[model samples]
Target chain A: MNVKDKYYQEVLRFWKDLTPNQRELVDHSIIKKHFNKGEAMRSSSDQCSGLFLIESGQVRAYIISENGKEITLYRLFDRDVCIFSASCIMKNISFDIFIETEKETTAYLIPTSIFDKLSKESMAVQVFANELMASRFSDVMWIMEQTLFMTLDKRLAIFLLEQSNIEESDTIKITHEKIANHLGSAREVITRMLKYFQEEGIISLSRGTIHIVNRKRLEQLTLY
Target chain B: MNVKDKYYQEVLRFWKDLTPNQRELVDHSIIKKHFNKGEAMRSSSDQCSGLFLIESGQVRAYIISENGKEITLYRLFDRDVCIFSASCIMKNISFDIFIETEKETTAYLIPTSIFDKLSKESMAVQVFANELMASRFSDVMWIMEQTLFMTLDKRLAIFLLEQSNIEESDTIKITHEKIANHLGSAREVITRMLKYFQEEGIISLSRGTIHIVNRKRLEQLTLY
Candidate 1:
């Protein structure tokens, strides 16, 4: 398959059970696009632009506070679908959430009008869409539980471990400030925690880097 | 219409655009039941029971920590549909959440088997279900924002304002413990905040009740 067909196939996997007519509607509705790292895909002021399906690379969905603090709600990876970006189509969600490309990303955008059309015609498409929404909801609920019940240190440890696994390396290239933003905390708090972790020989920090020296100990800390 | 049909009508409003055949499936599938106050509707150990459509009364969805601390995710009032309770039907959500009836609740329960069949055949059913899921996700995301960005005082103020409106009275008949449970804060923290609100003349406290004395001040506090 050519590049365009590849992207089309990526989205089709989610709706494999869709009828031929339903699939035709989806194929006609999607608009494929590319976004470079650090580019904003959707912002607070934008209406429901469309649903985004990440074919490759990464997208970070986050919200900023009125005082300018940022908290990452969740991240979308390859083959992930984001419906919140199409907020205009959803009546209940009105918060100022911004979607930014975390990596050079190629994605498929389905306009709200087409999405509504597909939703009105296909049960498979609707089931798939509802599952996507539920998964995201579960993510947000997990975040709330972590923020409300889990301590910052445990959360930081867990985040680092997850990042390391994602990169498949003990060395993680991330700054304390970025980590702070992701965890919805102050840079100073993250720095303090990192310093404590280093002092305990769990990690070693350098300019814009965190190296896990003792993965076993770090994993233990995350358990609490 | 008989009482049974009346209950079916309550759920049909959500799927008003559904085809006649789809409506027939829904009418045949729904099992209406009543739950007393403080009854557990679904627990972590239970499998996805079914989608719950609240015809009347209230349901509280919450999670309990390993340490036994409880934080409510959100509440469902009359005419609300809770899909999370039917988690088995949705493959993506695996979190352990409990649903409890906060008031004497009369509801319609649609089994996952019938729900899947209906969703597979009707676009309108699918759209309505997706909307319900999206609405709940928005509610949880809002909770995350409130927990992470807003201060205890502001949240408490907003909660009080909302509670007053829900009860349709200036005086809210609720205990500090219940309020803490709703906001996912310590009872002591809630007590301290209520005392502070009283000192500030925003509210007056009595046994099992709180009277909003200065609605303007409370509203102003929530804006922060």
Candidate 2:
């Protein structure tokens, strides 16, 4: 099925068991809008409504470090949604993360107040909330384990294997600086590693681009 | 209110709210039990019926690494409950961590089937699930941040402070080896840092015990 159709099916199924009045209430509470490339759905200190769902295009969620470095933790692609984090919206609390559109995007933003009302009143909404929380928690745990147990080279290899030719038509087009920031390593170290990989014929890097020429060889190198 | 009274009140309010006869259905599904000091209530690969609420005494949860080292992640004390974790009850999945009592303890364990049934249909049960997810996520984030950013010395300082008797006494009896495992560092590093702190008059260590001589100094070191 197409992405839009899949999303529509999901929302419909989520609200399928709910009464018609409750579903209508949620639909009315949702606000749909378009965000341009480089636009922010929400950033640090922006009081937002409830969590948002990414309907189309790509968005990045990142935090800026004390040294003025941006750390992109996760990318929110189509069909994914952000829920539970009230730091950006309510209480006027400061959040370190920025939610920026990587391309022109369309999203649905739900008001948290009404969301809570729905959750407090509806078992269907409560189940949806619990499932979303579990996913978010598992995502954080995965990131934590990656940072702790995985070496930089293994991390790079995993990222390459996961992203290569699988997403975005086999072309990542990511910059060295962004890769360094994501891996929490020095750009020089990445450059040196890439040079080694090139000599080993595992990968080729040229002009802000990296191409995986040999997947099996690359995976073997990551073992070290 | 007394702890026992508080427990019944909270549980009754939440569970009974689902239906007039909800407590009757749930009460028959719960099993109460006691565990002795230094005893494991749950272990890796041990599946149980449901969640355990620590009604009395203390329990520590830890994960054994591939190197046969146990990493301490959390200490559950009075009034806290373990729920929604596969480690607590899920079958066919190895427990991510083990739960053992530090002292003779009483806990109320609920049956998973009943809890699962109610959770899918009951708003109160879903709220409980949501809270558990949030709490676990916070814990994973704390441990992750420590592993990613904090140095061994700083982590050791925090550990000492946490274990120290700050209310009346200023001593910590937990061994340095235990602290090392919790901080994910070597015993030699902990030993050296303790010696340094002792020389600085911030602490004094003697034969399996550490006593804080300067509270302000120790706090300063931690801040550093």
TM-score of 2: 0.85
DockQ of each model against the real complex? 0.64, 0.31
Instruction: Please report how far candidate 1 places residue B202 from its true position, in Å.
Output: 2.3
TM-score of chain B of 2: 0.85
lDDT value, candidate 2, whole model: 0.67
Residues B25-88 of candidate 2 have per-residue lDDT tens digits of 6767778889899887776455454677778887877655556555566777777777633333
Number of backbone-clashing residue pairs for each candidate, in the order shown: 0, 2
Best by TM-score: 1
> Which candidate number maximizes DockQ?
1
Provide C-alpha RMSD values for all models, in order: 2.7, 3.9
Candidate 1 stretches with Cα past 4 Å from truth are: A1-7, A14-32, A45-47, A111-113, B1-7, B14-29, B45-47
Residue B74 lDDT in model 1? Answer: 84
- Residue A165 local lDDT, model 2: 47
How is the predicted docking of candidate 2 categorized under the CAPRI scheme? Answer: acceptable
lDDT of each: 0.82, 0.67
